[model samples]
Target chain A: MSSERSARSRHRAILVLTGLGLAAAAILATLDHFTHEPIALERERRALAALTAVLPADSFDNELVTDFIEIGIDGLAMPARIYRARLAGQPVAAVYDVTTDRGYSGSIRLLAAIDPDATLIAVRVLEHRETPGLGDRIEVERSNWIRQFSGRSLDDPPRQRWAPDRRDGDFDTLSNATITAGAVIEAVRRNLEHFEVLGESVWSDPEDTEHD
Target chain B: MKPEHQDIWRQGLWQANPGLVQLLGLCPLLAVSTSTINGLALGLATIAVLVCSNAAVSVLRGQLRPEIRIPAFVIIIATTVTVVDLTLQAWFHDLSRALGIFVPLIVTNCTILARAEAFASRQPLVPAIHDGLAQGTGFAAVLIVLGASRELFGHGTLLADADRLFGPAAADWTIQLLPESWEMLLAILPPGAFIALGLLVALRQWLIGQTGALRARAGQSEAAA
Candidate 1:
């Protein structure tokens, strides 16, 4: 009789524990349901804001996300996503999300936006693992070094001039972080050249080709 | 203050500080304390999570079986952190972005779990709340002091980018301690954090020793008089 009673108590303990866990899960799920929408909306708002900052404002009327295209190009580690902006049903600007592993530490992800004439609208570092207080100057929040890329076209500086100052390039490299600065300059130049070669095909269709 | 109140402050603020004494939750402390605004933002977030989690744990203490208490506490803390994290993302997007992974990393902070298990799980609702406030304040105080010292030396500025944490009105809150060209790169790096923390620990030890000696001298003087 005592053994049966002990078994019954153990069963009760398990039941209580399970019940409490379920209650906690239910409460959290409800809270998550309420908060998830706002968080998602905020993210969307920020993404649109970033798009406007890099691409010219008032140039594109249609939604950017709905016009997204994904293409895997040879010589690139990962497939790139391009957000094509259209004005009156014609493609105006393309923002390429490119990640280059040539940075001194980890990958440097950036949005290189190109205009219809193949001129660079802006090159903004979306994310980077470079050393802070040094290479981080690539970030628009940290410094205006990134602003120099705006309104620059492929033919203006010439292809060779895109190298870092250390490599006799026209662009100035970040102090004490030459490798990081060089990598960014190279990646931006390469991605811009890719956009030029691919032209409007980047938005119309996906293609994979090895271009150096 | 009443003895109970005093006990809470003494334990949370001085005797068992989460940053200096208890040495709990130092990852965010050393990382985000690079600037006063960052520290304050993270500190407030932590306090919010701590208070909410503590209160929840206390309310559910009776029903939580000992064998399953740890998991229950973690679930409660994670839920609280997620709520805080999502709230920040929704309302304070810029600060949320600046804080990045640290905001989510708060769930892993041992201090919150320790309090939930040790104090909140055994105590009533009121004391649990009080303990949370006290501990949070202690942690924030250290973060602010460290942040101030680091920012002053690192960037030669105080409350720089205050607007990032506050709002548009605080745009001019940045104070230039050094010329615009001067920047101590070391002070902004991880090594600076280690050095600053070491100095803070040394200062605390020195202060304790001096106070002890002063009290001894006072007793001798009283006896002689």
Candidate 2:
């Protein structure tokens, strides 16, 4: 008799637990249904903002977010999105959205904008998992370390000198963030080289380029 | 002014602060307290989750059996945290990015679960809600204090990035205490978090000791008279 009573209570426990779990799931699903659209919209807005930050407002007349081409590039672990900047139907600059896996912690995504003449307009870190106080100096908000890339081109720093000064290169390394600094510098240089190779063709239709 | 409500406030705030006394949720407390804005953002998120989870658990306490109570609490807390995480992502994009994984990790913050088991699950709805506010405020207070001290010492400013939490109108809320170039890197590192929290815990202990001694002395004088 005691065994049967205990078995009934145990069965009731499982039923109660299942009921609570289902209720929680229902609530979560409802919230996700409502928030899904706004979350995507917010992500797109931030991405567009990052692109805008890398290029001067006066430099680009076209919508930077909508004006873009996707291509697979070397050095970048993933396919890259190159956003074309135009001023009154003429190409002003091309911004390469690239990701590098060489950061001290993990992947670091960045934007490198190159002018028509192959000179760098600016570079900005979009996302990174780097150590906060040490490697986060790569952010334009944290320090002006990334701003040093402005006006730099392949020939100015030369091909071999495109690295942190710690490695005997032309660029200065952030204090205690040598690896992260090196990764950003390397990614920027690689993107510039790719841009130079593409030349005026970078502004051409996506089908013409053999980047695939 | 009810005795039970007052007792709850006393325990949550001073006598049993999650940060200084219970030492609950130390992971988020120590990790995100590097800046005032970061700490404040995470603290607010934590408070929201705690209040919601406590209330839910209290309302359903009768159905929870000993065999399944723990799992039930976990589901409720996890669901509340996800809702908060999504809400932040949708509305407060910048602050959400600043907080990163810490916001979702609020589910693992033992303070929420501890309160559910210790106070909320057994209490009435009103007192359960009261306990939630008290405990959450206590935890947030410690975070703000720790964050301010760390930001002042490490970055040489207080509320240095207020705009992240309070929008662009608060861009100028930063108060620079030291020169921008004069930063003590150690103060913002993990080791600094440990040291600052240790000092805070020691300060609380010293204050309690002093108050106890004063009360004892007053009692002895009264007996003599």
Candidate 3:
């Protein structure tokens, strides 16, 4: 009789704990649903605000998001998303991240902006904390090391032909920040070539880029 | 608070620092510390949950029998963390999303349950609250320091999204250390996070050593006198 009583009590304890846990989750889910929308709105507002810093407000009338498959470019192979901003019914700029594995510390994230004509416009350091006075030279403000790629044409930077001035190429490397600069140079090169191939898809009707 | 009760509070901050000494909650600590704003935001959310859970456990401690206490504590922590997670989702939204599933994962944070088991289950309300505050504050401080260090070296600025934590008034707080063209690209990578955190740990150890030396010297002088 005593053993049976103890077993019964243990079962009751389990049942009580389970009920409480379920109740807690249900209450949380309800609260989550109620507050989800406003939080999403704030996020959209922040993202839009960030764009103004990269592209002039008047420069774009629409933002098209799409997943485009990118083939081999400067030895990189992968698919990436492209955000096409159209102005006055013509393609103006494509904003995307250019990832490269050559920073003095580790991987680097570079934001590349290109014109509709498939030419590079600006390359900005979106994320990185490379060593100061070394890999930090990737940002244009740190030095003019990146400006050399601004006006260079496709013919000037042939297939896999673009490299740091050290390897004998159109792009010059940053003083002491060579590996980081070299990685970025090739990243821009690959990005330009990748965009050239996807030009037609990007120039497709603006409504097509929005992904579900 | 009781005299012994105060010691529980102090222990959470030093002897059992959640982020550092205990190393209990680390997934969010590493993922969100990319920028100071992200680190500060998540840290605040974690602290809110800790305080609520600790108090709730204390309030209900008397009703729970010894054999069933652990289950009761787990259920209580889960409930509080879930509530806190949902609140942030509804109110802060972007932070909730950027933090993503990690917010919900707080239910599994060992520190929360550990505190409940060690202090809240046996202590009174006020002291339990103090323990949570001290622990949460220590966790937040470590996160903010990590975030700022990572942001400054990796992104060439401090508090890249200051407004995320404080409000729009904080938008102007972002510091411009180097020009847009010269910032290094490696500081934001995961490896840099590891290296930077390692350096921070080393710095902490050095500080501990200095403090220990000072205490020992004082002890010798007092004995001689």
- Could you report the DockQ of all the candidates, in the order they appear? 0.54, 0.71, 0.28
Error of 3 at A104 (Å): 8.3
lDDT of 2 by residue, B1-225 (tens): 333888678677877788987899999999999999888899899989999999999999998888889999999999999999999988888898899999999998999999999878898789989899899989999999999999999878999779988999999999988997867888888899999999999987677678976556434533432
User: Which residue pairs show collisions in model 2?
Assistant: none
| Residue A125 displacement (Å), model 2 | 1.2
Compared with the true structure, what per-residue lDDT tens digits does model 3 show for residues B1-225? 353655555455555567766777776777667778877877887788889888988887866667888878877877787777767766766566556677887777777888888777788998888888888887888788888887777667887757656678887898878665444545666676677767866775566677976546434533432
- Of the native A-B interface contacts, what share survives in model 1? 0.46
**Residue B67 local lDDT, model 2:** 81
Which 10 consecutive positions of candidate 1 chain B have the poorest summed lDDT? B216-225
Provide the lowest-lDDT 10-residue window in model 1 chain A: A203-212
Which model is ahead, 1 or 2, in terms of TM-score? 2
- Please provide, for model 3 over A179-198, each residue's C-alpha lDDT reduced to its tens digit, 9 standing for 90 to 100: 77777877777788777766
Candidate 3's C-alpha runs over 4 A off are A46-54, A63-79, A96-111, A124-153, A156-161, A164-185, A198-201, A205-212, B1-5, B13-43, B62-109, B138-164, B168-225
In order of appearance, the predictions have TM-scores of: 0.89, 0.91, 0.65
Q: List the residue pairs that clash in candidate 1.
A: none
